[model samples]
Target: MRKITFKTLTKVFLVLVFSTTPSLVLSQVNPSPKPKSDFWNHVQFGGGFGLALGSDYTNITVAPSAVYNFNEKFAFGTALQYSYIDQENFYKSNVFGGSLIGLFNPLPQIQLSLELEEVNVSNTYQDFGEDYKDNFWYTGLYVGAGYRTNNVTIGFRYNLLFDQDIDLYGQAFMPFVRAYF
Candidate 1:
Protein backbone atom coordinates (compact mmCIF):
# COMPACT_ATOMS: atom_id res chain seq x y z
CA MET A 1 0.00 0.00 0.00
CA ARG A 2 1.02 3.59 -0.47
CA LYS A 3 1.01 4.25 3.26
CA ILE A 4 3.39 1.42 4.05
CA THR A 5 5.68 2.53 1.27
CA PHE A 6 5.74 6.05 2.58
CA LYS A 7 6.41 4.92 6.11
CA THR A 8 9.26 2.73 4.97
CA LEU A 9 10.77 5.59 3.05
CA THR A 10 10.54 7.84 6.06
CA LYS A 11 12.27 5.21 8.15
CA VAL A 12 15.18 5.01 5.70
CA PHE A 13 15.56 8.76 5.63
CA LEU A 14 15.57 9.18 9.39
CA VAL A 15 18.02 6.33 9.87
CA LEU A 16 20.42 7.94 7.45
CA VAL A 17 20.15 11.27 9.20
CA PHE A 18 20.62 9.84 12.69
CA SER A 19 23.31 7.39 11.67
CA THR A 20 25.37 10.30 10.37
CA THR A 21 25.25 12.26 13.62
CA PRO A 22 28.45 10.75 14.92
CA SER A 23 30.33 11.70 11.83
CA LEU A 24 29.99 15.30 12.79
CA VAL A 25 31.10 14.38 16.28
CA LEU A 26 33.97 12.37 14.89
CA SER A 27 35.19 15.34 12.90
CA GLN A 28 35.14 17.42 16.02
CA VAL A 29 36.93 14.74 17.99
CA ASN A 30 39.61 14.28 15.37
CA PRO A 31 40.49 17.96 15.59
CA SER A 32 40.32 17.95 19.40
CA PRO A 33 42.28 14.76 20.12
CA LYS A 34 39.58 13.37 22.43
CA PRO A 35 39.94 10.20 24.44
CA LYS A 36 38.88 6.75 23.26
CA SER A 37 35.76 7.20 25.39
CA ASP A 38 34.40 9.48 22.72
CA PHE A 39 33.88 6.46 20.49
CA TRP A 40 31.00 5.21 22.61
CA ASN A 41 29.02 8.33 21.87
CA HIS A 42 28.77 7.39 18.22
CA VAL A 43 25.60 6.25 16.49
CA GLN A 44 24.73 2.67 15.41
CA PHE A 45 22.45 1.24 12.71
CA GLY A 46 21.67 -2.50 12.41
CA GLY A 47 19.77 -4.82 10.03
CA GLY A 48 19.12 -8.58 10.27
CA PHE A 49 16.87 -11.64 10.39
CA GLY A 50 14.95 -12.94 13.38
CA LEU A 51 13.63 -16.47 13.92
CA ALA A 52 10.17 -16.18 15.38
CA LEU A 53 9.94 -18.85 18.08
CA GLY A 54 6.26 -19.74 17.83
CA SER A 55 5.16 -19.38 14.26
CA ASP A 56 5.61 -21.22 10.96
CA TYR A 57 7.58 -18.33 9.55
CA THR A 58 10.58 -16.37 10.62
CA ASN A 59 10.58 -12.62 11.22
CA ILE A 60 12.98 -10.04 9.89
CA THR A 61 13.44 -6.44 10.96
CA VAL A 62 15.62 -3.59 9.91
CA ALA A 63 16.23 -1.39 12.89
CA PRO A 64 18.25 1.76 13.15
CA SER A 65 19.01 2.93 16.66
CA ALA A 66 21.11 5.69 18.14
CA VAL A 67 22.52 6.61 21.56
CA TYR A 68 23.97 9.60 23.34
CA ASN A 69 26.01 9.02 26.45
CA PHE A 70 25.24 11.12 29.48
CA ASN A 71 28.52 9.58 30.60
CA GLU A 72 30.90 6.76 29.68
CA LYS A 73 28.98 3.71 30.91
CA PHE A 74 25.40 4.91 30.62
CA ALA A 75 23.42 5.93 27.57
CA PHE A 76 19.89 6.28 26.31
CA GLY A 77 18.46 5.84 22.82
CA THR A 78 15.43 4.88 20.77
CA ALA A 79 14.97 1.99 18.36
CA LEU A 80 12.49 1.80 15.51
CA GLN A 81 11.73 -1.73 14.37
CA TYR A 82 9.58 -3.11 11.56
CA SER A 83 8.90 -6.82 11.19
CA TYR A 84 6.83 -9.39 9.29
CA ILE A 85 5.95 -12.98 10.20
CA ASP A 86 3.85 -15.93 8.99
CA GLN A 87 1.75 -18.24 11.14
CA GLU A 88 0.37 -21.78 10.82
CA ASN A 89 -3.25 -20.72 10.53
CA PHE A 90 -2.46 -19.09 7.18
CA TYR A 91 -2.15 -15.81 9.04
CA LYS A 92 0.54 -13.33 8.27
CA SER A 93 1.37 -10.17 10.19
CA ASN A 94 3.48 -7.06 10.07
CA VAL A 95 4.63 -5.22 13.18
CA PHE A 96 6.10 -1.91 14.14
CA GLY A 97 7.38 -0.85 17.55
CA GLY A 98 9.28 1.97 19.16
CA SER A 99 11.39 1.41 22.26
CA LEU A 100 13.39 3.35 24.77
CA ILE A 101 16.50 1.31 25.40
CA GLY A 102 19.01 1.76 28.21
CA LEU A 103 22.40 0.78 26.88
CA PHE A 104 25.36 -0.72 28.66
CA ASN A 105 28.73 -1.29 27.09
CA PRO A 106 30.67 -3.39 29.58
CA LEU A 107 33.28 -4.34 27.02
CA PRO A 108 34.15 -3.43 23.48
CA GLN A 109 32.68 -6.69 22.20
CA ILE A 110 29.39 -6.55 24.10
CA GLN A 111 26.48 -4.19 24.49
CA LEU A 112 23.41 -4.84 26.63
CA SER A 113 20.19 -2.95 26.63
CA LEU A 114 16.87 -3.09 28.43
CA GLU A 115 13.89 -1.95 26.41
CA LEU A 116 10.23 -1.08 26.87
CA GLU A 117 8.31 -0.93 23.60
CA GLU A 118 4.85 -0.49 22.19
CA VAL A 119 4.02 -2.76 19.27
CA ASN A 120 1.28 -2.60 16.66
CA VAL A 121 0.31 -5.55 14.51
CA SER A 122 -1.68 -6.14 11.31
CA ASN A 123 -2.92 -9.58 10.24
CA THR A 124 -3.10 -10.24 6.54
CA TYR A 125 -5.30 -13.33 6.28
CA GLN A 126 -7.51 -12.92 9.33
CA ASP A 127 -8.93 -10.45 11.79
CA PHE A 128 -7.17 -9.89 15.10
CA GLY A 129 -10.23 -10.30 17.30
CA GLU A 130 -13.87 -11.25 16.77
CA ASP A 131 -15.08 -7.89 15.51
CA TYR A 132 -11.91 -6.90 13.67
CA LYS A 133 -11.74 -3.63 15.67
CA ASP A 134 -10.22 -1.88 12.66
CA ASN A 135 -7.75 -4.77 12.04
CA PHE A 136 -5.21 -3.08 14.32
CA TRP A 137 -4.32 -2.22 17.90
CA TYR A 138 -1.46 -4.17 19.46
CA THR A 139 1.02 -3.02 22.09
CA GLY A 140 3.73 -4.70 24.14
CA LEU A 141 7.02 -4.52 26.01
CA TYR A 142 10.33 -5.89 24.77
CA VAL A 143 13.64 -6.61 26.47
CA GLY A 144 16.70 -7.29 24.35
CA ALA A 145 20.50 -7.44 24.26
CA GLY A 146 23.19 -7.08 21.61
CA TYR A 147 26.82 -7.90 20.84
CA ARG A 148 28.57 -6.02 18.08
CA THR A 149 31.78 -5.15 16.31
CA ASN A 150 32.88 -3.14 13.21
CA ASN A 151 31.56 -5.91 10.90
CA VAL A 152 28.50 -7.57 12.44
CA THR A 153 26.35 -7.78 15.54
CA ILE A 154 24.21 -10.45 17.15
CA GLY A 155 21.08 -9.62 19.10
CA PHE A 156 18.40 -11.38 21.18
CA ARG A 157 15.03 -10.07 22.25
CA TYR A 158 11.99 -11.21 24.29
CA ASN A 159 8.63 -9.57 24.37
CA LEU A 160 5.56 -9.52 26.65
CA LEU A 161 2.20 -8.58 25.27
CA PHE A 162 0.39 -6.12 27.48
CA ASP A 163 -2.63 -5.35 25.32
CA GLN A 164 -3.72 -8.93 24.63
CA ASP A 165 -5.55 -10.98 27.25
CA ILE A 166 -4.16 -14.42 26.49
CA ASP A 167 -0.86 -13.76 28.32
CA LEU A 168 0.89 -14.76 25.12
CA TYR A 169 4.24 -13.43 23.98
CA GLY A 170 7.16 -14.18 21.71
CA GLN A 171 10.94 -14.41 21.64
CA ALA A 172 13.20 -13.35 18.76
CA PHE A 173 16.89 -14.00 18.37
CA MET A 174 18.55 -11.96 15.67
CA PRO A 175 22.02 -11.93 14.24
CA PHE A 176 22.60 -8.70 12.41
CA VAL A 177 25.26 -6.70 10.64
CA ARG A 178 25.56 -2.98 11.20
CA ALA A 179 27.49 -0.07 9.79
CA TYR A 180 28.71 2.35 12.42
CA PHE A 181 29.63 5.97 12.11
Candidate 2:
Protein backbone atom coordinates (compact mmCIF):
# COMPACT_ATOMS: atom_id res chain seq x y z
CA MET A 1 0.00 0.00 0.00
CA ARG A 2 1.16 3.53 -0.74
CA LYS A 3 2.44 5.50 2.23
CA ILE A 4 -0.27 7.65 3.87
CA THR A 5 0.95 11.24 4.06
CA PHE A 6 0.65 13.08 7.45
CA LYS A 7 -1.61 15.76 5.95
CA THR A 8 -3.97 13.11 4.54
CA LEU A 9 -4.08 11.21 7.90
CA THR A 10 -4.82 14.43 9.76
CA LYS A 11 -7.70 15.25 7.34
CA VAL A 12 -9.20 11.76 7.85
CA PHE A 13 -8.98 12.03 11.66
CA LEU A 14 -10.69 15.44 11.68
CA VAL A 15 -13.48 14.20 9.40
CA LEU A 16 -14.20 11.25 11.74
CA VAL A 17 -14.29 13.52 14.79
CA PHE A 18 -16.51 16.13 13.13
CA SER A 19 -18.95 13.53 11.74
CA THR A 20 -19.33 11.55 15.03
CA THR A 21 -19.52 14.41 17.56
CA PRO A 22 -23.07 15.53 16.70
CA SER A 23 -24.56 12.06 17.02
CA LEU A 24 -22.71 11.46 20.30
CA VAL A 25 -23.99 14.69 21.79
CA LEU A 26 -27.54 14.14 20.59
CA SER A 27 -27.65 10.67 22.11
CA GLN A 28 -26.93 12.04 25.58
CA VAL A 29 -29.36 14.98 25.49
CA ASN A 30 -32.27 14.93 28.01
CA PRO A 31 -35.75 14.64 26.50
CA SER A 32 -37.87 15.86 29.47
CA PRO A 33 -38.34 19.48 30.46
CA LYS A 34 -37.58 20.76 33.96
CA PRO A 35 -40.49 21.45 36.33
CA LYS A 36 -41.31 25.03 37.18
CA SER A 37 -41.00 26.39 40.70
CA ASP A 38 -44.09 27.22 42.75
CA PHE A 39 -43.47 29.83 45.43
CA TRP A 40 -46.63 29.32 47.54
CA ASN A 41 -45.90 25.64 47.90
CA HIS A 42 -43.06 26.47 50.29
CA VAL A 43 -45.00 28.85 52.54
CA GLN A 44 -46.96 28.08 55.72
CA PHE A 45 -49.25 30.32 57.74
CA GLY A 46 -50.18 30.00 61.43
CA GLY A 47 -50.38 31.82 64.73
CA GLY A 48 -51.87 32.05 68.24
CA PHE A 49 -54.84 33.76 69.91
CA GLY A 50 -56.00 34.22 73.48
CA LEU A 51 -58.97 35.65 75.36
CA ALA A 52 -59.55 36.04 79.11
CA LEU A 53 -62.50 37.54 80.96
CA GLY A 54 -63.11 37.93 84.68
CA SER A 55 -65.12 40.00 87.12
CA ASP A 56 -62.38 42.67 87.26
CA TYR A 57 -60.15 41.91 84.31
CA THR A 58 -60.35 41.46 80.56
CA ASN A 59 -57.67 40.50 78.02
CA ILE A 60 -57.57 39.58 74.34
CA THR A 61 -54.67 38.69 72.08
CA VAL A 62 -54.20 37.95 68.38
CA ALA A 63 -50.97 36.89 66.74
CA PRO A 64 -50.68 35.85 63.11
CA SER A 65 -47.53 34.56 61.43
CA ALA A 66 -46.18 33.09 58.23
CA VAL A 67 -43.02 31.20 57.36
CA TYR A 68 -41.09 30.41 54.21
CA ASN A 69 -39.70 26.92 54.41
CA PHE A 70 -36.26 26.69 52.82
CA ASN A 71 -36.36 22.94 53.01
CA GLU A 72 -37.49 20.18 55.35
CA LYS A 73 -35.23 21.40 58.15
CA PHE A 74 -35.10 25.21 58.09
CA ALA A 75 -37.56 28.09 58.10
CA PHE A 76 -37.61 31.88 58.46
CA GLY A 77 -40.75 33.77 59.42
CA THR A 78 -42.43 36.88 60.73
CA ALA A 79 -45.33 37.55 63.10
CA LEU A 80 -47.67 40.35 64.05
CA GLN A 81 -49.09 40.69 67.58
CA TYR A 82 -51.93 42.72 69.06
CA SER A 83 -53.10 42.62 72.65
CA TYR A 84 -55.75 44.52 74.62
CA ILE A 85 -55.97 44.46 78.40
CA ASP A 86 -58.24 46.19 80.87
CA GLN A 87 -57.82 45.72 84.61
CA GLU A 88 -61.22 47.25 85.45
CA ASN A 89 -60.38 50.42 87.42
CA PHE A 90 -56.60 50.06 87.34
CA TYR A 91 -55.50 50.34 83.75
CA LYS A 92 -56.28 49.80 80.07
CA SER A 93 -53.53 49.08 77.62
CA ASN A 94 -52.88 48.16 73.98
CA VAL A 95 -49.77 46.34 72.84
CA PHE A 96 -48.92 46.01 69.15
CA GLY A 97 -45.71 44.78 67.58
CA GLY A 98 -43.95 42.46 65.18
CA SER A 99 -41.19 39.87 65.36
CA LEU A 100 -38.68 38.11 63.13
CA ILE A 101 -38.02 34.44 63.78
CA GLY A 102 -35.69 31.71 62.60
CA LEU A 103 -36.33 28.00 63.18
CA PHE A 104 -34.18 24.94 62.79
CA ASN A 105 -35.02 21.27 63.21
CA PRO A 106 -32.18 18.96 64.01
CA LEU A 107 -34.53 16.00 64.34
CA PRO A 108 -38.01 15.45 63.02
CA GLN A 109 -39.46 15.84 66.52
CA ILE A 110 -37.23 18.59 67.89
CA GLN A 111 -37.21 22.28 66.96
CA LEU A 112 -35.09 25.22 68.04
CA SER A 113 -35.79 28.88 67.48
CA LEU A 114 -34.47 32.42 67.87
CA GLU A 115 -36.60 35.53 67.70
CA LEU A 116 -36.34 39.31 67.95
CA GLU A 117 -39.45 41.23 68.92
CA GLU A 118 -40.42 44.85 69.45
CA VAL A 119 -43.71 46.19 70.74
CA ASN A 120 -45.27 49.56 71.28
CA VAL A 121 -47.13 49.69 74.57
CA SER A 122 -49.77 52.35 75.23
CA ASN A 123 -51.24 52.36 78.68
CA THR A 124 -53.86 54.52 80.45
CA TYR A 125 -53.75 54.20 84.19
CA GLN A 126 -56.59 55.36 86.46
CA ASP A 127 -55.11 57.13 89.53
CA PHE A 128 -57.30 58.91 92.05
CA GLY A 129 -59.98 59.82 89.49
CA GLU A 130 -57.30 60.98 87.04
CA ASP A 131 -56.12 59.28 83.83
CA TYR A 132 -52.37 58.98 83.41
CA LYS A 133 -50.81 57.80 80.15
CA ASP A 134 -47.56 55.95 79.59
CA ASN A 135 -46.26 54.99 76.17
CA PHE A 136 -43.07 53.17 75.31
CA TRP A 137 -41.40 50.66 73.02
CA TYR A 138 -40.11 47.34 74.37
CA THR A 139 -37.67 44.95 72.70
CA GLY A 140 -36.94 41.31 73.43
CA LEU A 141 -34.66 38.59 72.14
CA TYR A 142 -35.72 35.01 72.78
CA VAL A 143 -34.15 31.61 72.36
CA GLY A 144 -36.14 28.40 72.70
CA ALA A 145 -36.60 24.70 72.01
CA GLY A 146 -39.73 22.64 71.60
CA TYR A 147 -41.36 19.32 70.86
CA ARG A 148 -42.62 19.36 67.31
CA THR A 149 -45.25 17.34 65.51
CA ASN A 150 -46.39 17.62 61.92
CA ASN A 151 -47.90 21.07 62.26
CA VAL A 152 -47.77 21.88 65.95
CA THR A 153 -45.04 22.72 68.42
CA ILE A 154 -45.23 23.07 72.22
CA GLY A 155 -42.39 24.83 73.97
CA PHE A 156 -41.12 27.60 76.18
CA ARG A 157 -38.79 30.47 75.34
CA TYR A 158 -36.57 32.61 77.62
CA ASN A 159 -36.08 36.28 76.85
CA LEU A 160 -32.44 37.29 76.93
CA LEU A 161 -33.34 40.95 77.25
CA PHE A 162 -35.99 40.63 79.92
CA ASP A 163 -36.31 43.31 82.55
CA GLN A 164 -38.68 43.09 85.49
CA ASP A 165 -38.91 46.86 85.67
CA ILE A 166 -40.73 46.91 82.34
CA ASP A 167 -43.24 44.39 83.72
CA LEU A 168 -44.62 43.54 80.28
CA TYR A 169 -45.07 39.82 80.88
CA GLY A 170 -43.66 39.91 84.42
CA GLN A 171 -41.28 37.06 83.71
CA ALA A 172 -38.35 36.06 81.50
CA PHE A 173 -39.80 32.70 80.48
CA MET A 174 -42.96 32.17 78.45
CA PRO A 175 -44.74 29.11 77.13
CA PHE A 176 -45.98 28.89 73.57
CA VAL A 177 -48.12 26.67 71.37
CA ARG A 178 -47.63 27.05 67.64
CA ALA A 179 -49.31 25.54 64.60
CA TYR A 180 -48.80 25.82 60.85
CA PHE A 181 -50.64 24.79 57.78
Off by over 4 Å in 2: 1-35
Going through the candidates in the order shown, the clash numbers are: 0, 0
Candidate 2 residue-wise lDDT at 93: 95
Native-referenced Cα lDDT, model 1: 0.61
TM-score of each: 0.49, 0.79
Could you tell me the lDDT of residue 166 within candidate 1? 27
Which lDDT value does model 2 have at 60? 99
Give me the candidate number with maximum TM-score: 2
Taken over the whole model, the C-alpha lDDT of each candidate is 0.61, 0.96
lDDT string, candidate 2, 37-155, tens digits: 88799999999999999999999999999999999899999999999999999999999999999999999999999999999999999999999999999999999999999999999
In Å, residue 121's CA in model 2 sits off its true spot by 0.4
